[model samples]
Target: MKTPNHFKLTALAAIFSCFVLTACNGANSSTASSTADVILTIPVEAVLTRHGEISSSYRTTATLEARGEAEVISKATGIVQHILVEEGDAVSAGQLLAQLDNERQQYSLNKEKAELNRLASELTRTKEMHERKLISSDVFEKLQWQFDAMQASVNLAELALKETEVRAPISGVISRRYAKLGQLVNQYATQSLFHIVSNQQLEAVVHLPEQQLAQARIGQNALLEFAGMLPVNAELVRISPVVDAASGTVRAVLRVANEQQLLKPGMFAQVQLQFDVKADALLLPKRALMTTDNSPTVFVVNAENKVSRKPVSLGYQSDNTVEILSGLALGDKVVIAGQSALKDDALVNVVSVKQFE
Candidate 1:
């Protein structure tokens, strides 16, 4: 039987279509395989266990304030003549805070000064007269004694004059005021002239329970975090060596240096006392860690470009890293990213190994 030309043409077209489809499908498969075989650059870090110290910190609340503060008060009885400083004013040592009525005191001082001058001149003249035997020894001695009494009076008067001017015993800002203009202040007065606190240098006081008290000592390192303030570097300045029987807590004072005036008195503070130190322990970034069924695991990359799940023995954890006690060694490559999709013996490509600087 002879084949038709149109039939042969149609059959040829179908075969060509089949060949084209097969070639297209093969190309698609190749492209899919290439996409699946992804070469990823991952950041890695070497596991290093060095003989250094790691501290375990205990958190406690505290109050920030100057090491010392006090209220300025009049030491003598007087009527206020002038108010030298106001609230929020900064005063220095011996800086006049207020002035008292000194008219009477000034008059007394002047009288004492005149008597001292006259007595001193008489004493000089009497000594000269005695030396030359121009006067009796009793007369000269009496003149000398009178001169001593005048000198003592002058000294007392000068002290009274100084007391008229209220001065600051320390340098600080006046946070409050009680005495006003023309106010009568008495000696050993209980009223406060000005409340001054030294904020330039501050300290934080924390109360620690007896259980954690032993971990604290003088000069131990500490960290202070104040509410709405940055973390500050501090150290244990004083520890009540004995725990308070009433509260069952020990008092710890940490000195906080605030050259920038960042810390304020009565501000809430959180203190961390670091005690335990671990040496020769492997540590990893906290983000590089993952947990499985309560088992802490890390994705470690082997030399063959394969990732395997590893169980790590962790010791102490810090703000940024976790201390690993075992299951890791120095120079071991650990993956920090893409850990969620990692599996045992899964193919991987190390992007980078983060080096410690």
Candidate 2:
């Protein structure tokens, strides 16, 4: 028998309702899956916290200087007759550097020597005459006085002649040559014939903050950096007992050996005065620190790749690294890059990881 028309219409409506519900559920599932896949995950670079060495240090700039320097000057007045050494010549102490005109000096010396010889012969004759009772005692005494006076004059003449040769007062390399051949030089002139500097060792004076005076001590290690050169090692050789009132700093002297003569005077350098060091310290890269707040803060990544903002207490800080006193542990990954875009408990995708040795 055929079904009624109203029952057929009701069955069709029920089927239509079921189809609409199924389509809505399918759309909702697709959208939910897409949303989950698009969840924001920031890409960042991170480094694992590790135990390493950190040092408390003070940094300042200084100009290098030769520890030993000398200005060779003319001891006698004459014209420059010879130039034995030039700029950049290596010389030793007492080495002849130049020669001045000694014609006048030589003539004076010769005259004094001749007079000394004459006086010596006359004195010998007078002594023999006195011994033979032919000459009076007064004559012998007078002759002896003349001979002594002539001998003193001869000594002075010899010294004057010797001074004509300019000698290096110290062993060093000649940095400047002021006198040229045939140039007249005066003994009392303010000009220097040559400037010699010993580069076997170098020194630099740094003024550190007064607060660091106590920490600075003799025999402490220091590092010096110059532009376009590798760092050189130095030592704290001296410290000023008093602090400078005007600058509120203390003067400290650092000495470095330049056996190869690689370092020169007047070179500007960056100086690091290391006071204390911690051998095994929880170290973190300084780049990871975020100072937006009052205290230092860093974002640490957990095992699930989620970042959490942490406030860390600090200890000694060296170059590019800081000692993490608290709020961190060894092997904890800390976000170094892309931290600006991060918040607490944010999802992160560590693009790269760096390990500190």
Candidate 3:
């Protein structure tokens, strides 16, 4: 139906006005929805900051070793008569450990003593003759030399006889027993009789990179974690003065106390040498921090129940916790979980608050 031109223009204007009005209303509704969503709070788990001890540690692995060890060699040459101690036996210093064939030594010592007694009696007679001027000075001097030689032979025989009884050179656990009863042993250094080690104190032997040489120090506190065992306390006892050219690592040692005798030599352990510590520091769990950026960041929940993105400076960091040098304080709450969806000044609901022990 063809209508008048003015009427058609009026109808088109009316349609355009209606479309613009509907578009404006829809935009206003979308703005209101966005505002409502902005007010919505996110649920998260948080940890409260506290003043405690925090430390920076250098972590490395090492093998357990005995602080005092020795391989004892036989000192007597004869057939082994008896082995008093066996492997896994504890021994005290100077305690008899083994007995070689001492019968022959005893016989020789007795013969030498008899000869010494005979010489003593002859020397007395010779001295008496010399004093009476019946014997020449040369004869008296010969008798004196003979008597001295006999005395020295007897003394040597007694010493050799005593050596047949092998005594423990040090107090330690018998880790190895190479000597056997009725087996021929020699005084030569090549024949090892026993291996003794003082297991009461252990050592963690580790190699440190040259860069850490400056940080390694004697008497420094350390923590050791061994497999199948609880964590043990240790102290830095030694640091090598030279570097190994082949590995380019310096040798470092930590002493571990073993009053319970749990630590054994050759066991591998994880060592964390505490190089620096901050006492009475504001600390938080490392999970509370977002470290995947140029600067370390955290989401701190304020008293208003809003989350604020914070960039913080750190002091010392251990494996689990880190010291907050700035941008956080004691009693401040930090988001430890459900922080991926958080934003600055975002409303939040803390479902749980954990304390750092």
Candidate 4:
């Protein structure tokens, strides 16, 4: 049938537009299929579980103190004339800590010296007289005795003079100063002149319950943890031979060598003692275990990359690992990371494997 050229042209243009639209729709469908065919995977990190040694640690609070300490005291009855050191001053054995006024001691020493000189001269004269028969033997012997007594007196006075200087009895840091300048100090006084403590090595003094005595022993390894400080190495040095009847506790002493002099006395620290290490124990990182339904559970991946929520029985827990008593076998792969985003039977792609070091 004859039709208008403008109408024919319009119909042709409409058909071409429809063909282009159909082609575009087909391409979109193919692209969507390609995307769907690609297997969606969740990247994750995993570890191959194995059996390792694990131990349970018991913690007790303690204080780090000097291994050796002494109370310095005055040796002579006199007033404190001078103090050579203050608190926190490091001192050595026999180092002068304070000095008493030496006026009286010096006078006594001088008097003894003059008497000894006179007696010595008298003895010399008496010996010459006795040898020449100018004096009796008895007189000469008396002069010799007098000279000996005077000499001994001089020795005593010299010793007393030395006692005027109060010296440290031990090498340590001065922790407390009890003597003040011009303070009357007695030789027989019970008051301590200075409190000195050794800082070269420290002790972790702990009083543990009697029950813990079974685990604590000499030479056992221990760790000392201080605030804002790294754990220090320590060992059990002493255990009290007897337990306190009132507290039912036994005293334990752990020694920590402060070779670098990093720790000071009276610092609070926690003592961690590990015991009963279970070798060949089925262990896993603590992060792998999660509380599921109020029970310890873990996500274990299978060969097909499918996860299974495993309810595990735990025995002991160490620093960052736990002992798996049941519900897992050796050579199983565990999801240590990305475990929170998984469900039972969920597919996963292990992006990386973590090695135990």
State model 1's lDDT. 0.80
Candidate 2 Cα misplacement greater than 4 A, ranges: 1-3, 33-37, 40-42, 125-145, 291-293, 340-347
User: Model 2, range 234-345, lDDT digits (tens) per residue?
Assistant: 9999999888999999888999999999999999999998998789999999999998557899999999999999999999987788999999989989999999999998
Q: Sort by TM-score, best first: what order?
A: 2, 3, 4, 1
Instruction: Judge candidate 4 against the unseen true structure and give its global Cα lDDT, from 0 to 1.
Output: 0.87
List ranges where model 3 is wrong by over 4 Å. 1-40, 291-293
Which run of 10 residues does model 4 get worst, by summed lDDT? Answer: 34-43
**Global fold similarity of model 4 (TM-score):** 0.70
Residue 182 CA displacement from its true place in model 1, Å: 1.4
Clashing pairs in 3: none
User: 2 or 4, which is superior by lDDT?
Assistant: 2
- List candidate 4 segments past 4 Å from native: 1-47, 50-53, 122-149, 188-191, 276-282, 287-299, 305-316, 324-330, 335-357
Please list the C-alpha lDDT of all candidates, in the order they appear.
0.80, 0.92, 0.89, 0.87
TM-score: model 3 vs. ground truth: 0.84
- Give the count of colliding residue pairs in each prediction: 2, 0, 0, 0
Between prediction 1 and prediction 3, the one with superior TM-score is 3
Top model number, TM-score: 2
| Candidate 3 residue lDDT tens string, 1-357 | 666998989999999999999999999999999988766878999998889988767888988889899888777799988889999999988989888988999999999999999989999999999999999999999989998999999999999999998888888899999998788987875688999999999888888889888877789999888878789999988898999999999988888999888888998888888987778988889999897578899999989999989999988888788898999987888999999999889888899998767
Backbone clash pairs for candidate 1 read 41-351, 42-351
Q: How well does candidate 1 score on lDDT at residue 162?
A: 91
lDDT of 1 by residue, 1-357 (tens): 557988999899999999999999999999888877763433344343333456777788888877768888877788988988888787888899899998888899999999999888888888998999999999988888888888899999989989888899898888888888878898875667888988788888888889987666778888887667678888888888788999999888888887787677888877788777676556677777899999999988888878889999988877777778888887677877778877888787666566441
Worst 10 residues of 1 by lDDT: 41-50
